[model samples]
Target chain A: MITAAVPERENYLNNAYGIKSWLLTRDHKRIGLLYLFTVTLFFFLGGAFATMIRIELLTPQGNFVSSETYNKLFTMHGVAMIFFFLIPAIPATLGNFFLPMMIGARDLAFPRINLLSWYLLVIGGLFSLFAMLAGGVDTGWTFYTPYSTTYSNSWVIATALGIFISGFSSILTGLNFIVTVHRMRAPGMTWMRMPLFVWSHYATALIQVLGTPVVAVTIILLFCERVFHIGIFDPTLGGDPVLFQHMFWFYSHPAVYIMILPAMGIVSELVSVFSRKPVFGYQFVAYASMAIAVLGFLVWGHHLFVSTQSVYAALVFSFLSYFVAIPSAIKVFNWTATLYKGSISFATPMLYAFGFIGLFTIGGLTGLFVAALGFDVHVTDTYFVVAHFHYIMVGGTIMAYLGGLHYWWPKITGRMYPEGWAKLSALIIFLGFNLTFFPQFILGYLGMPRRYHVYPDEFQVLHVLSTAGASVLAVGYLMPMIYFIWSLRYGKVASANPWGATGLEWQTPSPPPVHNFDVTPIVTHDAYDYSTVIGQEVEVG
Target chain B: MSEHIDSVKTYALVFAALIAATVGTTAVAFVDLGPFSVVVALLIAVCKMLLVALFFMHVRHSTRLTRLVVLGGLLWLLILIALTMGDILTRNWVGVPGR
Candidate 1:
């Protein structure tokens, strides 16, 4: 009988001795671990706020919390989740760790800047946590003006400050990834030879570098007008409030692409690997990621259909929004085509990939509905918009994030997560997620508005259904937290290349070395070259 | 990885051109070019922008990839400002009823 034989001693986890080593280390892998730890805490904090919001929505009346408190709950939830969690979720952690490794580099182009980006995120998170603890902001995560500036007396500046500082983290990370990809590839690992994960991340970094600062400038204008009377977004001082929407969504719209593009990249890797075939139309999948990033910048005006922007501009934006769906559709088609006539595996990662394709398709189709000027005018502020984004953000990105996490778990932790438990959790999360958000699409179509805790008697049943699903979703999320921790102590030790994957990352030992590859790799084939995995590259397992 | 150094003469020429463009912008602002006054000033500004980006910012010595990405960012910025300004300026274009 064959058994796993790779030694796990003296890895990056064991090379460092104390807390100071991790905090001060420039090793990309350790920094990835640090991002994983901090990002998970923010995830649960966001999740807890979401829990409270769902619980309150269970009944027709605002019985769980007061109206003001509900406002704070959703605002903090969106702020915690969007800026802190979703924007940096896949890229900062998984992409930070794996991107350098896959490209056959020891670290990002500037290792110090990589560490600085993590610290920036933490400090930014602190400002947000301070805002949450100090009475919470109520102007919505969008932070619309006059209300954010004048009327609603919540911690708008503090939350905006947190968001402001976090934008630098994004900008720096984008700059780092762009430079690293351009300069740091191993010999023969040309641009096309790099994995789709790196390709997607490259696109994500571009958005971060170019788009994030727009929102940063918007935020600076936000509080400047509030505190210094800059007359930018405030209407009482002759500012157009819709200008706030323009600058905010300029980044925020592409920001959604920032969240999902890397997830799509992960799904690309997962589909190719688990299907045991080279990705069908690999070049198209790679270019599709870039196309989505580019087209994503043009469609921010879809958010403004009912904001009373010019109808002509809205018409152009509405037309452009349909174009983004093309590149995203290319990705889904290729993933499906890759699976066709291939030796497929039912791994937990593949399960989430499947979940992502179906739900994202639903989300993308519904987006076309609202992209219409006529339809969006009716359902602009309703639960339909909320459901559409949740499908993409939650159903799409989070599913792909968890899938990537599980796919790379053995490489990151040197232990195999229990397959049975992981599969169950993925199933639970998928089912619970649909149960929760699917009804909201119907609720919004029936004209149920979002962000309001109280509603009429008729909407209670669907609310109860959603709340019930949220409970199950909570259980689904909690299982992975519990079992993943349990796996660290008692799980089977993972072998290098346990999945027989073909990326350069899998060429190294499980958990990898402090500098990733012991010697720099010289790539010889494409990213999905599974034939290379069968002999010399395959270690004992 | 070799650093590309520009000669002082090159730098001096670029600086003189920038100063000349600044004077041209000011001179254009004073002219009664009718509706084209804004257009003329903007044209001079664009020339200044190209000069600074190519010479002062080192894009002239940078890699082709760097030049492409820099162009992409500038084009995207133009999209944001121009499209947004277009949206705001055309509110009256759709023919409202009252006036």
Candidate 2:
């Protein structure tokens, strides 16, 4: 049957009532919902700031707002998007929702800490919100020293404190996922037997635990320098500002992996389930996530190529940066191979998966471009670098994030989203995303620096086109959000294992019980064991 | 999770040794072994970290996975410090583009 009964039985959602149930719930799934609601707000908040930036750039005269306002807009946009939205987007919401379920555990190892992690994120977000309301920070999200520590009179401390508090959220979430994955699997669910999604989350958790502390410490040192007259980053105070850059990028680079790895995990599940095949080189894809995490740390120096960092260090970083691409390439090749001659279905989720592969490849290749010491010299602080990261984060991660959201929405909500609207929005997002960022690559190549309110008239046409695309992209983003909400009440009910997919998650009822399963699943086959999955209605154990 | 548990005696001895190391680190500070001073201090710090991890944190009695994670954390910490210090120390070394 294509549909099943509306979830009449008590589930996680129906099992609770009132704001108190959500605000203080110990269920990982409930906390995940709490995160979903919160980060979605931050996403649009970031998007609104992005809208102002695009509108201001429409004619390239900086006429829409003052240069100072533009700086604040972009800074807050980035601060909201990166620290609050993207960093926690998939992990906090979807990962929190499904990680325990996918591994056949009752919940995360520490359910109370899971709820605490969500609270920390909210508290941290409030700090940033307070900063924004009181005339936003002007230093870019990178928060480079001297300008931030010595010169700027913006709300640097408030925003930095917000991020500092949020870093613990990341750290605790990672700690919870790691310990859970290590100890919580059901019988027969060994490491290799586990889903790639779990593997990717495991890798991301490692990065979050190990890398976030560095950034937190850097923020603390920044706070000390700014609030107290300490010289840690203030040049006049015998502190070296370049050291601040070193420490900040040290975590920020790995933080990039922290964003993409979970999304990559989502793609692994999408490609396998829709194609009706096991992942090609499952082990390679799993290890690639780890490779990216570890290698992500070694390459932060590449960001310093145009800085005061030594040429020798930059060269080593340049070389190591290319090495990180090998594992990424392996995953890309394996996914493409997974689709070869398989019964591939271009559902909404699969469509997004395809977009992820194509765009992520473009992003990863451009990464190699900037990895070159000479090439990065030309494009440093330019729109090319901006375009490159938007491709990775927006084009790549957001696409997979949407794909994962759609793939699991049935399971999460017990309702199937309107497939037609989902497909159209997927197409719109693809076209709109390309339209928005593609020209920036050209404009950057043509020598337009980022963070400038005004630019040469020669760059005006590309800027206009980019603005037009941003509007469309904004529309594309809004559609699923509207439809996803619409689906909750009006949409068709979802059957257990509606997609007929493998994994312990699909075995239980849609939206599952508060305890997750009627019985603990004993996994007897490797993940994506299609023989057991196809032509079979998955029954609750 | 580890089944093995340490007795109070083991904990007390480890605690005493930790105190001794703390005093030794300060005492060695006055010796000033030139280039080796920082290295000596760091070695003692490493020992102290290991002692805390093995005994107080119970890593020594924990599962292999737990010990590996502790070690990974230490390795990652080394990477952060080493790379940052490497860049700082090398900035003034004064070398050519390609030698």
Leading candidate by TM-score: 2
Residue-wise C-alpha lDDT for candidate 1, range A6-90, written one tens digit per residue: 8747788998799899899888888888998988999999999999999899889888899999999999999999999999899
Give the runs in model 2 whose Cα sits over 4 Å from its true position: A1-7, A536-541, B1-47, B95-99
Residue runs of model 1 more than 4 Å from their true location after superposition: A1-8, A535-541, B6-56, B97-99
DockQ per candidate: 0.62, 0.59
**Total clashing residue pairs per candidate?**
0, 0
Give the Å shift of residue A443 in candidate 2. Answer: 1.1
Candidate with the greatest DockQ versus the true structure: 1
Residue pairs of candidate 2 with colliding backbone atoms = none
- On residues A1-541, what C-alpha lDDT tens digit does candidate 2 reach at each position? 5886675799999997999988889999999989999999999999999999999998868799998888999999999999999999999999999999998999999999988898899999999999999999999999998899878989999999999999999999999999999889999999999999999999999999999999999999998888898999877999988899889998999999999999999999999998889999999999999999889999999999988887778888999999989999999999999999898888999999999999999999999999999999999999999999999999988999999999999999999999999999999999999999999999999999999989999999999999999999999999999999999999889898988899899999998899999999999999989998767753210
User: What digit string (tens of lDDT, one per residue) describes model 2 on residues B3-27?
Assistant: 7888999999999999999999999
Interface RMSD, per-candidate values to 1 decimal? 1.0, 1.0
Compute the lDDT of residue A511 as modeled in candidate 1: 85
